[model samples]
Every structure is written in C-alpha cells, then in structure tokens.
Target: MKFYNFMTSQDSSVQLVDQAVLLFTLGEEKEAESLLVEYLSRHENDLSAWRALSEIRLSTKDFSAAEHACRKALSINPDDLTSNVSLARILVSQGDKEGAEEASSKARVLGWKDELAQDEHNG
Candidate 1:
C-alpha cells in the first residue's frame, strides 16, 4: 500500500501507521501494536490510526482493547461506517449481542448514506 495515499495529514508522524501496518502484515504484532500506541499518543484524533489499532487488537483476540480503540475512532467520526462495523465486530466478539446489533444498524445506515452520496457524486 502507498503510505502517502493513506495519510490524511501532512504530519510526518502519520508515517508510523504505515510502518506499523507493514509490521503487522509481516506478523510482528507486538511491534506493530507498540508503534500504533506510540503514534496514537501524539495523534489521538486520527480516525484511521485508531481503526487500524482496533483491527490489530481484534486480530490478537484482545476484544476489550479492540472495542476501546474502535470506540475512540467512532468518537472522532460517528458517521464512519468502517468504525461502526468494527465496533459491531468487537461487541460481537465480547458477546454483547444487543450492542453489536446497534452498531451494525448504525453501520448500515452510514453505508447507505455513503452509497447515496457516491451515486449523487457520480450521477
């Protein structure tokens, strides 16, 4: 993946997320998590980074941490479909069926809106 494409900000610190993703892909979960934690410390409001961290935690079976990270992402952008979906997944993993359902519903609504927006843009 192109690091530049994923970056929403010009700050050099964002590159850490790209590196962390690469490390995660290489099976270095601990290192990747460490980097993500470090990056988040400086850029707490980065939605993508929080989502990425949530994914890493989810993959590691750290459901609580994943939920926390996903919630952080949602706090930054409540309309983010991806974060809502992630939250649903985390909740499901933790056996919170009602919460998962709520999150899933939110994601579906956001996804519908996104599709509508895309169609509008294209049409």
Candidate 2:
C-alpha cells in the first residue's frame, strides 16, 4: 500500500494521477478509482496517467479496468515495453493464459532485440 514515489513531482500528469495514487496507497481503493475515472475524462491519451490508473486498478483486483487502460496505452505506442508487460499481467489476472503467454513472448523478443541494439551502440 505504499504510494508511488513520483506522485509528488509537479509534472503535467501529476495532478491527474497523484490523488488516486495517494488514496490507493492509503487503502481507499474505491475513492482512488473514482479519481482515476475523473482523470481519464480529460487525459484519456496520457500514457503516464493511464499507467498509474491501470496499476491502481490492478491493485484493487479490477482486471477489466486495468486491461482497458493497458490497451489505451498500447494504442498510444504499440511498442511500449511497459504497456506490453502490463497488458500481459492484466491478461494473467483475468485468467487469459494464452493471451498472457503471447504478450510475454512478444515482450521477450522485443527486449532481446533492444538489448542487442544497445550493445551494438555501446560497442
């Protein structure tokens, strides 16, 4: 139930996500989720906001909402590694083992390529 560390930062999306993060950390999941829904109204395409909201939903055992947020994030950037991982996790939470495994496999392939590219750059 620990608050996310970056919630206090004065970033543009901070206001949209901070209250929910704090409420969730304090175990007020229902209150936090209300705030998340409100945030989504104005910042539907904010990836960071979506990620925070998704994390809170997952913590509260709301797999469907988490999956929705994750999908929104993926729509913004299909190759986003974090969103891929989050979607996989949400799929697992929903007992969609095949979907989760597919996402995990994709993530692994992308991560491996990214690491190789980084190695080439460093070499």
The lDDT leader among the candidates is: 1
Q: Model 2 segments beyond 4 Å from truth?
A: 1-10
Task: Please report the candidate that would top TM-score against the real structure.
Answer: 1
lDDT value for model 1: 0.90
lDDT by residue for model 1 (1-123), tens? 655555456455557778888999999999999988987898899888898899999999999999999999989999989999999999999999999999999999999999999999999
lDDT by residue (1-123, candidate 2, tens digit) is: 886666433475776577778888899888888887787797777787778778888887889988998888888888878888888998999999999999898888889988999999999
Question: RMSD to native for every prediction?
Answer: 5.0, 6.8
> Which residue pairs in candidate 1 collide?
none
Total clashing residue pairs per candidate?
Answer: 0, 0
lDDT for each of the candidates? 0.90, 0.83
**Backbone clash tally for model 1?**
0
